[model samples]
Target: MAGLPSTARVVIIGGGVVGTSSLYHLCKAGWTDCLLLEKNELTSGSTWHAAGNVPTFSSSWSLMNMQRYSTELYRGLAEAVDYPMNYHVTGSLRLAHTKERMQEFQRARGMGRYQGMDIDVVGLEEIKRRYPFIETHDLKGALYDPSDGDIDPAQLTQALAKG
Candidate 1:
């Protein structure tokens, strides 16, 4: 800690995903006099246990937009920083077991379409085709979001800190 700066325009409290991301964004916006302090190593807290899923399927328009933004950001973050985030572009599926559930998925698909998302209400056959190991007999269909994916939480934190 001897070489640490004594003054900063902004001080972030932790080194987890949110904190590191905040610091990174601040620097990106030309706020370079920012410092981040952590009690332990980066991602030593709840961020270590996070699933790090980037899902874009949402019923709310605002939430869907946010999710979409997050997905897009994560997709390009690793390349921007020249760090490997282990981000996977594997799509997601919300299984619909009954007609009511299928109806709900249809509504969500329509909403996604309006937002220019690549979402579809796929039948059981399509689900099985995409994922052969899944048991789809009881499922009427699924709400599929091709943009949904996941990332390594620790790697993401490191990348943000590097930025």
Candidate 2:
């Protein structure tokens, strides 16, 4: 913490993933005069227990785009930073046991299509093919998004902070 600046163009509150990410992006965009303040330790809040699921499938086009952007950003940041984010693009599957859930998935898939996301509603056989361990007997279908995955939120936040 030596040579701390007396003034910063941007003072971001919190040291969580979002706050650090904002600081990181601002720096990347050529704004080096920024400061991030955390009342407690970084990622000690909700980010610590987050599922870390970076699913791009959403009923809203805007949300889907934002998730997609975040996923891409995390992927690039993991490679660029010395610290590791443990990002895993293992994809995601949302199971639908009931007809109502199936319809919801279908609608979400439709929304994803407009957002340029490759999401699909797959039958039980396809689900079983992808995830053999899943118990697909009771499932009507599933929504599969190939780009969806996860990352270590704490590690990502650390990397962002380092940047």
Candidate 3:
């Protein structure tokens, strides 16, 4: 950034994970002459309120590609970089006791199967074995997306900015 001119080639509008991710990738791709302008502090707006869920298991090819890259980025933070992202890889469990929700889950599962994410159907017994903390009495079954997970928004933003 030192040798780069004052008039940067790219100007990013936000300071959240989305914007930070763009900036990180741009820098990695050698777009050194770029600037990200935040109207407020980093993670001050909607970024602060976001419950950081990995948006994987998408049906659309474009969404799937974005999520796949996002997953890889988060995994890199957990593995190569010393930047701990407060990420929990316990997985996502969508429970359904009623017929309506079950139908929706089935449709989504079929799509995820095509997308190649680690999403699958699980029964009550499997749910109990995987996550004993939940009370699964009335629940019929669940769609367990194994690669699905959560993250700490604050830490992730800071880490991406620094990285």
Task: Give lDDT tens digits, candidate 3, residues 1-163.
Answer: 3553568899888999888878988998999888987888889878899999886765466786677567767877755546777877767788889877777677777777776666787889999998888899899898787777788997788788887
Cα error of candidate 3 at position 10, Å: 1.4
Order the numbered candidates by lDDT, best leading.
Answer: 1, 2, 3
**What are the TM-scores, per candidate, against the unseen true structure?**
0.84, 0.82, 0.75
lDDT of 1 by residue, 1-163 (tens): 7988999999999899999989988988999798899998999999999998989988788998888888888888988999988989899889998999899888888888988888999987899999999998788999989998888999999998887
- Candidate 3 regions with alpha-carbon error over 4 angstroms: 1-6, 58-61, 78-81, 98-100, 131-140
**lDDT, candidate 2, 119-158, per-residue tens:** 8999989988998888887889999988888888899889
RMSD of 2: 2.6
Record all residue pairs in model 1 with backbone atoms less than 3 Å apart, i.e. clashing.
none
Angstrom error of the Cα, residue 23, model 2: value is 1.0
TM-score for candidate 1, residues paired by index: 0.84
Q: Name the lDDT of candidate 1.
A: 0.89
